[model samples]
Target: MTRTFRGRVSRLTAAALLGTTLLLPSSAGAAAPFPYQDPALPVATRVADLMSRMTLDEKLGQMTQAERGSVTAADLTAYRLGSVLSGGGSAPNPNTATGWADMYDGFQRAALATPLGIPMIYGVDAVHGHNNVVGATIFPHNIGLGATRDPVLVEQIGRAVAEEVSGTGVDWDFAPCLCVARNDRWGRTYESFGETPDIASSLTTIVTGLQGPALGGPASVLATAKHYLGDGGTTGGDDQGDTQLSEAELRAIHLPPFQAAIQRGVGSVMVSYSSWNGVKLHGHQYLVTGLLKGELGFSGFVVSDWNGIDQIDGQSGFTAAEVSAAVNAGVDMVMVPTAWKNFLTLLRAEVGNGHIPLSRIDDANRRILTKKFELGLFERPLTDRAWTPTVGGAAHRALARQAVAKSQVLLKNAGGVLPLARDNNKIFVAGKNADDIGHQSGGWTVSWQGGSGNLTPGTTILQGIRAAAGPTTTVTYNQRGTGIDGTYRAAIAVVGETPYAEGQGDRTGSMSLDRDDLRTIATLRKAGVPVIVVLVSGRPLDIAAELPGWNALLAAWLPGTEGGGVADVLFGVVPPTGKTPMTWGTSVTQQPINTGDGKTPLFPQGFGLTY
Candidate 1:
């Protein structure tokens, strides 16, 4: 009787196996479902199960994120690090789409090789359309997009950014910077959408579009609302400056966009590199723990910006103990670009000694896991490989072209010299930016501060002018005032900030014009020629000091890669609709002005007088 009963059970088990095989797709033959989550089980139940099975080492590893090159595949298995990220401009072996994919796949494979087989999440800035990668569609900086005041367009841009980023297997974008820029002199002014809380909040819908549905859907790249809690309100409009604000002011000014982002289910919040009222954001338990997690009920994981944790002690050097302190302060992911071992060893020692609570570790891991699950990473272990067809494809370029065209604001069209004679006989294009890609791209392009001319293949303003001038327009280019002839129909002078970044571009409260630029503009003006000044800069220079010399002025605020786009509007192929997103103050004294300050900006925030 026992033999007969065993035989019957074996037969039934075989029948059930046959039914399961029939249920799955034939194309999905022999594929193993990701062990992290089973659709047959509830999401919460799956997360809990995964957490329960993880060892203490695994849990701690889940709470940390290491840079890509800091450790090899062997270290990933040994340490079982939960995430890996490419720091700014950190590319794969070749920096191509396939290169990014291969790098991501290799790292993920290593992490999954551990006993739990959990995949590591990869992240990049993708701040302006996967910008670190060569040939990716570089869009207008956030400030330019703010001028459109079109949240829908911003969302569309976000969607395109998501598609391109995810195409290369990246799952997170540190973007939709919700900074209400208080000073134009801030080098990172281009990164912020606007100076008002409303604009920041409204424009941040890009987060929703990028992340997609909370449950599960395509186009689901995790969005991070970054540099959290008063990054823009720093003293002297400083980069990483101290923001001394009343609690009410903090809540009213900086907290709204975070709140809005949270409501939209933003996947993560990167702690600011700056301090709030003398408290370092990376070490501020009151804000990171009490406010962000407790009061605001943010369930998303908190990440530290690049080397942000190290800056906590200010003058004091960062040690393992200090890193552990910042981790305990509520940073789920630490971007220790060069010191992964220090973070790992210190964190483990802290956990062992009870300096860091296991509950905190669990909470951090859980938050990250929830985001991964929300991203459907558990279900779709592999990204859609077919995204290659659309990565930096025509549609993205078309949108980038549109963004470029609209971002051109006609600051001045005096004597209607611009929309210059389309059939002009000669147009002299003078300045470093005439044939330069890096100068036009400004900060955060190919390199951190960007380079000058031909760093990448794109039409420079000179190229566009030449293309639009047809066969008759003679274009002359010179760097240091040598290539000038007596007469030309019009001279287009492209001048402004060369190439710089935060702290490097820090001014003592004035937009000092480059003396050489002034000489060039003045020289051209005195040559008995019509000179059109194209100011290419991150901040609005106090051009009133210099504008008296030029016949027409165009505020082309660092139009990226596509300098030809500027000529598109300049020669009347496209009309300039972009108004000044940030106020172009007449002078430094007229700054810090908003709509309600009872004093009008030299040009109101929405001011753009077009021809």
Candidate 2:
């Protein structure tokens, strides 16, 4: 499915393969040094040399990625795992940057203990700035970054994220989700850049930043061009649901981002859990193998989403057929998480039965091992702690602040109500998202389905507002708009969706503000004070009916850690420049509204009001 390869060195052919002039097994039964161990050798040559010496068990291990919690250090060596990963919220005991580094080193040591001594690659959902670690700098989600429409800034953020991830010894980042979010109701809409191939394609600059000028550069992490094709265009904005589209439509809307990503030398491509035309993507040979690999010439290894192969047969757990189908479909490495052992067994059985050819295994190994060699993992396997200090450091936070500021979309500023003067400004902040760090950070912060309260250390929007307000200004806050009046210059209501990742975040029903938000706005309106509504959400909420009652509206789409960016714009330190990445619909009825769509939008794509 990947490609045809050259002949391999069989165990019996080992002596015949290398010329007799080369060093042979000595009288002491010790062997000569391998070419694969030499750093000067080419990556393909090293991969070939290594593959020649590998057994079937070792080759299978190279194609498997196990979760950190499920696979112990001993298990790593026993299985000879090719990769280790910390799933969202799956962290080490201390959970600090150093703790992560120590954990990564421990696993590396176990992996090196194997006969082949192949160093395992570690991966994380560092989608938004080493999000699993507590103190790592958290950046705005993709939708927010898309609103900024600044690929250069996004690339800078990607570099910062790569550095932070490197500090934790995480060699791979499953990030820069290039999904062209077509529907507002999709829970992962925040993960997409915008509702077009062009926006997503432009943002693939992040892949370059993540991988550096080339693979193995300083702080360079293996970037993944994710959920491979047509994840964001699913019917009804479903999570892991069918995307019933003709091949042409899929290629036009969804394929371009991946094309752009591959051009940037993205190290891997993660297959989507969702299906296309009722055929699951994990098992879609035409798309994954034929289109992505053959047509597009994606030489990098293809990876499966978290247990994505299980859905190939529309079943709860994966079967041998699914395993063979996935491998035959060109999924080089599988993210088995907890079920890695079962997967290894099934894959071995499948390979033994000839369902998955040995050549496919070799191709998978060659692609994966080539990256490992290119990464210089064999030479520098340990965590590079030099970049450790930058995790959640001031510089990255400043960049995040700038990004957050740039991401602020001012949808409505009636009578120029924003740029609220800092000095002598009586700002009353209220609503659920005002002071909560977890709320501001949104999903994929410390956990998969990110939560509220102080889950990690970062500035909340209210904290940012107070700091910006300074000593001369008076700043008051409440969860609800209990105490606000015309006496205050403006009542800032920071209200929107709480944390939700995939399935739970999907809003099949009305996409309007919750009752709590509506009630809070009513309470603020009751005070007869100017209401400055700062909506902190992943996607645009249906707020046309409520827009008139508010004095001003700022779409602060899930600004992570550095909430001060929102404050910077609010107090005129930074002018609002973010444009709407997606069209804002008046009501839930206009569900799939976009730039070219026939339905009238409340705010068209790229629309933004600037003072």
lDDT by residue (234-256, candidate 1, tens digit) is 88888999989999988998899
The digit string of per-residue lDDT tens for model 2 on 478-570 reads 878887878988999999999999899999998888999899999988988889999999999989999999999999999999999999999
Candidate 1 lDDT score relative to the true structure: 0.76
Q: For model 1, name the residue pairs that clash.
A: 436-453
Positional deviation of 96 in candidate 2, in angstroms? 0.3
Global lDDT of model 2: 0.88
lDDT of each: 0.76, 0.88
lDDT of 2 at 344: 96
Candidate 2, after superposition: displacement of residue 585 in Å? 0.3
Worst 10 residues of 1 by lDDT: 2-11
Worst 10 residues of 2 by lDDT: 1-10
